[model samples]
Target chain A: METLSSLAVPTVLILAGLVMARGKNAFDAFLRGGAEGMRTTFSLIPSLTALICALSMLRASGAAELLTELTSPVLSVLGIPPEVIPLAITRPVSGSASTAAFSALLEETGPDSLAALCAAILMGSSDTLIYVMGMYFSRTHVKKARRAVVIGAVGAVMCLFLSAALARIFFRDAA
Target chain B: MIGKCFFWICSVSMVCSVITGNTSKLASAVFDGCADSIELSLSLLGMMCLWCGVIEVFRDAGFVGALARRLSFILKRLFPDCADDSDIMGDIASSVAANMLGVSSAATPFALSAMEKLDKRNGCGDTASDDMVTLSLLGCSSVSLFPTTVVTLRYAAGSESPYAVLVPVLICSVICTSFAMLLSRLTAKNKPLGKEKRKSLGKRKERL
Candidate 1:
């Protein structure tokens, strides 16, 4: 599994090499494209800076914990384990933060625990909504992302519920 | 809209921290966050440069067009509003292909490029178009064939069966993606371009 996952980049490189070999002015095109990418990256800095600052503030202020605790009642009713609440709250906003939360959950509950399994599934099945939103909109200079953010959040919440349900069904006997 | 949200969250959090007397912690977090964002953007710059270059080669060799042609049937269905010969279609195809393969770092450039193409087609000035919203939604929903990072983490954490979550991840991802597509289609406000408009846009693209 590890070998297969690591092969994605090599496969892409090989394919790109084959295609470039057949193309005219491949080097020039590559350089131009890289320059364009650099421009996009330059434009991304402001938005990324703002969003990350806000995220850091939220984390440091313990707002994320507060939000998680506030939502735990509803999540518990939905069969989500208490240990996974922080993961759910942070998953959309920050990838690294949620991964940290997930690792903490695993360490606290042991990797084989049902909560750990559910956390893994939730983490795997959802993208970082806010991060993607920031990157995409910043690149395109789109001012209105409410619709995209709302829809993405809805999908993440739906996935969370589904992950918990599936974990219950699959890991019931083990637990 | 998102910018306001970020500002609001930052202010609210800052106020709360002040009220809670965590001023020192808040100050440190602000500096650390700025530093972290810069580091992340720099790393992303390298990855984007590499993949964008490769994508350019693919475009130069007409591989993207060929791939788009092969996948046009599904692409047309997913993005019916986008024209058949639009370069955006090829970009979208490449982005989705990279995403499903679980190489998100490689996927970012294609996704960003696709959004730019969609923005051009929409002619919305600075606002997001319906297709852009849909594409963004699609990008956010995890559609990877293998949840590689999650599995690796589980294994490192000493799980005996790290692959145990694979099936559930696949099922949930499919559900989330389908739901997002459905919602986006239902709520999309931008009307499809007229036939003449599409033709003119295609001509403009060709002239470029």
Candidate 2:
């Protein structure tokens, strides 16, 4: 209820702007971007949608819960709180879903919680490399990206690791 | 297409839950979760439109061209295969600018346009040169300094301190971005620069 209203505010504001700009070539730009977006969505969404469904089943079946339990102690050495495992798992897979997961953590456990902070930090800093990158580059003819791919994946993980480490440093008291 | 996929995923997940006799629980959970998601997406859409309009205004005011001029050096280093006058700079700048606003959707076309501009400039119709790949990859991993969409989601979800992630987000983005740039330079170095332009890419100190 509160969430939907807050969300509606921005959409309405943009709608107003769109109305104002409607006569100023906004409609054409919107349609063009929409069409292009639709095409690109087709290329990637099939596989991604399937994965999300599978993941949802996993989440429902408590696989994520089990995995979180399994990795919690090991990740404790890494300084990431147990609650952040979902973010570390999902952010690399789906940014939006991770955002939801992280926000739910905030709502359930309170926002200032170090785990929520780490999850938020990780989400903001890292890219959904597997999904977004794979989707985008599949459109172009890019074959020789071995080094780029390596650097990208490694850098994403490094950022994830750095987020956990720095979160512990910043929120040592909170933790 | 995505809509169909979503419909399918929902159906499949519902079937799975029913088989496990937890359909009601998961469905209710999904319903609540989706309400939040739709809202967040709306907020993101608005913020993205505002930023897009702002970027358009900046472009109208010659800021876009100025940015291209300012990025000539780093752009030169990152994309030595491209000429100074190429449209790749605009694409990169626009894409980066869009990402800065947390509008990944808005950034996509600009990124594609940028890559296309690079390919055309290098006269590589089929095989993308290494520089293009690095730039595209770097763009994909934009490592945003601020994540407005995520924060908005948090705030809407009743986060007590939505801004707490800001500092860590900036730090991690800076590290990842620097790491990406350094790695890109090392990988793409001296390969396309041949023998002449390689020297120019070295520790260039200049003001545009």
Candidate 3:
């Protein structure tokens, strides 16, 4: 119930500084955590960079746009609007990519669009299975990447359902 | 170092993204998108750094290890292949902690680490371990308390109905988690975690 998350890092730092004055162990703990935090974050660079780069290229080359154009008709049937298609397509590929798409959607269409809802559902419910599997599992020495796909597919379908159901019930902008 | 490398990579990629545009208008759209993207990256950087700090405090307090032990029960059910205590469990705790805050991107490495631990024990056997399957199936979904990306997207889009999504998302997360758990329970058994590991984990707990 009590999460340090509620406390800003500065406040936490001040508190920890008090705790530190009380005992060196607390300071040690904070330093250790910061070090580990930095290291773990650094490790993500490989996957994070690749994902951004790929998505960037996709966007730059109009691959995302073309893909959107192709999927637009199908997405239309799902009640997802045109502006939101990029987020939908990108969501499963990379969270950052989908986020970039969401930004564009928000910039172009406004956030209340039905498409934004769909994109959000996609992000909330889904995983970037391919990137995850490739990076995490590959290092873990897992040979097969197929299972991640299955799980990803399941997540995607569930997201699709949730989006549609919510759109039907809450999204009044059928126009 | 990695952060700097990736930051530049992202910047270049975004610029490349602009130039590669066959049409001119989309270049602006892509640039506009990057503004928010950069902000999100900063927030994630700040938030995740803070969590990492909290985790260190938890480590010093010995709370994370204890929490890991408690979670090991459920984890045991999911990853019979892994040791009782491990860095992976610690990672899972951090991952879950991050997930609670709507930092799924931050959680991926931990989830992968946890899965790797489970898979290590998966043993090149005929059937995949039940725990491995459950971990895969249960996975991570956005829970109720904090749904940052959802809120952000809505906010960015200028949603009059931004908060309107809270209930539906909360309910959907619960239902989907339950559904995945149920299905994992029914199917994973035939694959592995049958009568044996269940009894084994129970005995282990009794001893603990």
Cα lDDT, model 2, residue A139: 56
lDDT of 3 by residue, A17-120 (tens): 66567665776776666676666555654454444444444465565566568877986786665665656555655655565556555555556656666656
The candidate, 1 or 3, that scores higher on DockQ is: 1
Cα lDDT tens digits for candidate 3, B1-208: 3344345534655565566644554455445444544554554555455555655564565543465456556654544445466676667665655554443555567777777676666664434455555555545443434455556456545666555665556666666666655556565544335677678879989999
In model 1, state the lDDT of residue B190: 46
| Alpha-carbon DockQ of candidate 3 | 0.27
Question: What TM value does chain B of candidate 2 have?
Answer: 0.67
Ranking by lDDT: 1, 2, 3
What stretches of model 3 exceed 4 Å from their correct place?
Answer: A1-73, A79-83, A170-175, B1-98, B101-113, B123-128, B136-144, B161-163, B181-208
Q: lDDT tens string, model 2, B26-60? A: 74565455454445455445444544454343334
Docking class of 2: incorrect
RMSD to native for every prediction? 8.3, 7.4, 7.4
Candidate 3 clashing pairs, residues 3+ apart or interchain: A110-B157, A111-B157, B78-B131
Native contacts retained, all candidates in order: 0.66, 0.28, 0.27
Best by DockQ: 1
Error of 1 at B124 (Å): 4.6
Off by over 4 Å in 1: A1-72, B1-71, B190-208
Name the weakest run of 10 consecutive residues (lDDT summed) in model 3 chain B. Answer: B1-10
| Model 1 interface DockQ | 0.39
